[model samples]
Target: MKHIDVKEIISSKEFIGQEITICGWVRTSRNSKSVAFVEVNDGTSLKNVQVVVEKGESDYKEPRVGMALKVTGTVVEGRNNTVEINAVPEGITVLGDAPTDYPLQKKGHTLEFLRTIPHLRGRTNTFNAVWRVRSVLAAAIHEYFQTHNYVYVNTPLITGSDCEGAGEMFQVTTIGYSNDYKNEEDYYTNDFFGRKAGLSVSGQLEGEMAATAMGKIYTFGPSFRAENSNTPKHLAEFWHVEPEVAFAELNDVIEIAEDMLKHVIRTLLDKCPDEVAFFDAHFEKGLRARLEELISHDFGRVTYTEAIELLKNSGENFVYPVEWGCDLQTEHERYLSEKVFKKAVFVTDYPKEIKSFYMKQNPDGKTVAAVDLLVPGVGEIIGGSEREADYDKLIAAMNERNMNLDLYSDYLDLRKFGTVPHGGFGLGFERLIMYTTGMANIRDVILFPRTVGSIR
Candidate 1:
């Protein structure tokens, strides 16, 4: 009596008529005078298997929703052209019982309520589909980089310098609220790392070092930002996918980013058809068509100046006014990608002042070789820039920003020694999942979302 998976039994015809053992949590149950019908899901598939128990069956009990059950049964062609399990006498075994207080019921529940119980949300259809697509997309990311000969680098979680220069980091410390320190410097000196250290906001800095040595490298790991934003798009902790390429210009990385995204979309469409359909039918209509459209068309490309001009000329009322120097907001980004381009667009050559300190300064003196990939619905999907390879310019930029150069001495060493033209981009893994699954909130995609004022 081999235990068969619900997914296998539902997807294959070979399992029909064969006596098999299956174990899963009961999703739904209905009982009559002589027969009991229980729908069981094993987490292997979104669909549940129907287990029919006849009267006078040995150890047979009316299964309740959320109860764990093991049963031996013969598969038979059931109603509506589907297969079902006919439980043998005395074959039903209750592994675990669910109390009446079980939160999950047959009735529909809102996403808000599901967030309160992150532990049991996986059993629900919506979350089960979301997690399945997340797994496939994660694997697709690794596949894209590995096939391109990029070395996967595991960047450190704790760091001494802020990569984004935002100063919004969750500080890592051994001393907790101890008033024994003399001053700011002396306080840090007494701490574990002997200096200020915090969770990394981005892995691009160290990824550049690996890229310089290995020619190409990528990092996929947890990144933390301690911003007090309670928006759907912001998260205190999230996963980041960054790939750094040596001897590559801004345009080179843009092409790579486009190709990699198309590959991921195509892979997801192929591997997770059922889950994709689920999202399309429930979450967002035309979701499948949107994904197909992205892979079918070449992404649009425009300079930052050109994009701003397009926005300004369109005459659409925008909350944030379009300006050459100001950063593009989500509204402006969506207008460019969704309304104007009708596809993914790469906006390049942003004003240097608005971007980070490491970007290469263009010859125009006002802009850096930075690029952002914007798609419909989602504003900025990927952002990267050609790093300032020149040591003098790198130092000048850091000085202009009034940064403490000593903290980034090792990062500066990369520019000083054997520096080559290099560039890379970061893709917020959750954002990508949100885009693919049509999940409105970032919390719905991640298993345990860490946001402002909420650790659970």
Candidate 2:
């Protein structure tokens, strides 16, 4: 008989009384004098299937938690309206034996402890639910873009330009720590690419190039940063979802961001019911309601200046005091979304001094046409801006920043050759997962999270 997944065997009653085979890792096992109860999970579902073994069975062996087993059995109606498997005679085989020293036990393990054993943590309830939701959310993102007539583009992982201008990029070098060169320029000349190259911090630049031609494009891939901050919200490597649209302005991309996020939330709530319920029950109470509330109403909108005024007058004791031209901190952002607006809010037209050089300069001569989407639980979930389409303005902005004009000649060429008011936004995929699943740490949502001094 074909091996049926534990998820299928437990979810439906069609397999009752039918002989079948199943393979999975033991979650928990209880052995009495005459019978043994083994709960097994194949990572297909949040719940497990109970495998009952009789003491007289020839091949019956006491299965331990974390042990991989293959069992041929007959599905039967279990107690309390559930389905279980009754192992047949000589039908139990141990594929892999986890000894008594197995790290995972029936007892609860803290998230910090699980990080040390990233390899085995996926078998746990929390990680299994997180990964399952992650898979569904990834697919939902693709579905949303594809159905909306957006072209999916793959930007290069390695690039010669820093998209965010922060200079926090991981250098991709062929040379080791050897003083085998004359100068900074000469050192890179002998290296691969014959110039400075690093893992991309954002795909927005290449994504803009694709958008100008393809009309609408988005890139979903891994992004790297070399920041040294050790925080629950920060990561060295994370997935980025960026969408660029031609003939679009700051307001247009803001609408796209809101609609795309709502669609993704609806998809998650509909498809991953069990996983969401588990997260809601354990991780964050009312997580499901929070998601529903987001989709129920329109996001609030305010200018950066207006937001600053609101914060200054709100009389809330803020850790970082609110002021004009100063970038809004998480406290301020959460206050606007959670306390003031009570929903997702868009703060737009920030001062050009604090914003990137690529953003379009507004008529006021002080602020850029930039916007950040702040949600209730997570602040600044999405950041985007209208590109500076005028060649002179872009050149002036680059020159003011003392940027290397030679490196960005290709990106500059896009403006010179019929640029049409293009714009885009980037969504940190892990941040979205953290908001949806209520997983507090950025480390927990990602598989094998690469954080400060932690690669394993």
Candidate 3:
């Protein structure tokens, strides 16, 4: 007997009256005198297949909730044109048994409680919906880039350079420290890779090198950070979707970012309507409407200087001071997107000191062409900059910050030999999923989320 999926049986009505074998875990089971009704799910879809097992039909005892089962049955039409299975006596097998202490039962579970058991949470309806949506979102990201002729490059996981220049990075080391150990700094000279290396925080630098040769390229991979923030918005390890384009400026990067966001949202709405509907009903009311508005309306665009002016005159008491050079806080970004624009907005031309050294310097030598895209609920989902293609200015920016020139010689070489006007942006993949699914915390979207004081 050929095995059939629950989704196939539920979605295809032609399978009615056909004999089939199905394998799934019991979601809920109830036994009557004549027959036993079991709701079985195979993780193929949110809906489960209803199986009717008559008395003396199976060799084993009554199946309990969470028991893995395989049964041979005949499919018949249920009420409202749905299809169900009628299990035969000789074809039922209990693949695994669930003990009485099984954590997940037939009751509602709190999200906080689910976090404790990350391994088994995926079986629940809420997490099943979340992970399915996450899978679709990931596929949509690759589709958007691939259809645009962007070569997918797998960037290195370990690197010796810091792309963001922020010192908050996790270091990779193999040397053990002890009282007898000497020359602690020099020990790295003989360690793995022959020099200091750490997990990559962003693939932008390498992605740019490939883009200069391939015209357009993207990287979808995991990046690590060592920040100690325990907020719902931060994660120690997460995925990033970074795309680089050759000969593109700030405006060009902004257009690409906007288009990509819309494409992913549209794909999610079309592909996973059931999953998206679940989030819309429970997590955030009017989520579908908000997504519809975002794709239809033009994203608001403003400069960092103008944003500071607007905030200063609005008479809103902000905890962080609104200044031209100061970095925009989460509160500021939310205000711009939620209160002022009421949609996604791009704030560009940030102060050079506040941004990375690679951003192109404006003619005034004060601000760089750095841009951040802030959405209605999440602040700053995408960040990009028109790079400093001019080799001299690039070197000067590096020098002002006292960056180690030796470590980034290869990156500097990109500007030296046949460099063009290029730009790119990094999108937080987990945060994007949060926005699409209306998931409040970044940890809830990622599987086995790594945060402060939590490794598993």
> Where is model 3 more than 4 Å wrong at Cα?
56-60, 178-181
Q: Write the per-residue lDDT of candidate 3 for residues 273-305, one digit (tens) a residue.
A: 888889999899989888888899889999999
- Indicate the TM-score of model 1: 0.98
Better of 1 and 3 by TM-score: 1
Clashes of each: 1, 0, 0
Candidate 3: deviation at residue 91, Å?
Answer: 3.0
Residue 3 lDDT in candidate 1: 79
Error of 3 at 238 (Å): 0.4
- What TM-score does candidate 3 get on C-alpha atoms? 0.96
Tell me the TM-score of model 2. Answer: 0.98
Compute each candidate's TM-score over C-alphas: 0.98, 0.98, 0.96
Error of 1 at 28 (Å): 0.5
Task: Please provide, for model 2 over 324-421, each residue's C-alpha lDDT reduced to its tens digit, 9 standing for 90 to 100.
Answer: 98999999999999999999999999999999999999999999999999999989999999999999999999999999999899999999898899
lDDT of 3 at 213: 95
In angstroms, give how far residue 271 of model 1 lies from its true place.
Answer: 1.1
Q: Kindly give the stretch of ten consecutive residues in candidate 1 with the minimal lDDT sum.
A: 55-64
lDDT of 1 by residue, 326-433 (tens): 899999999999999999999999999999999999999999999999999898999999999999999999999889999999999998799899999999999999
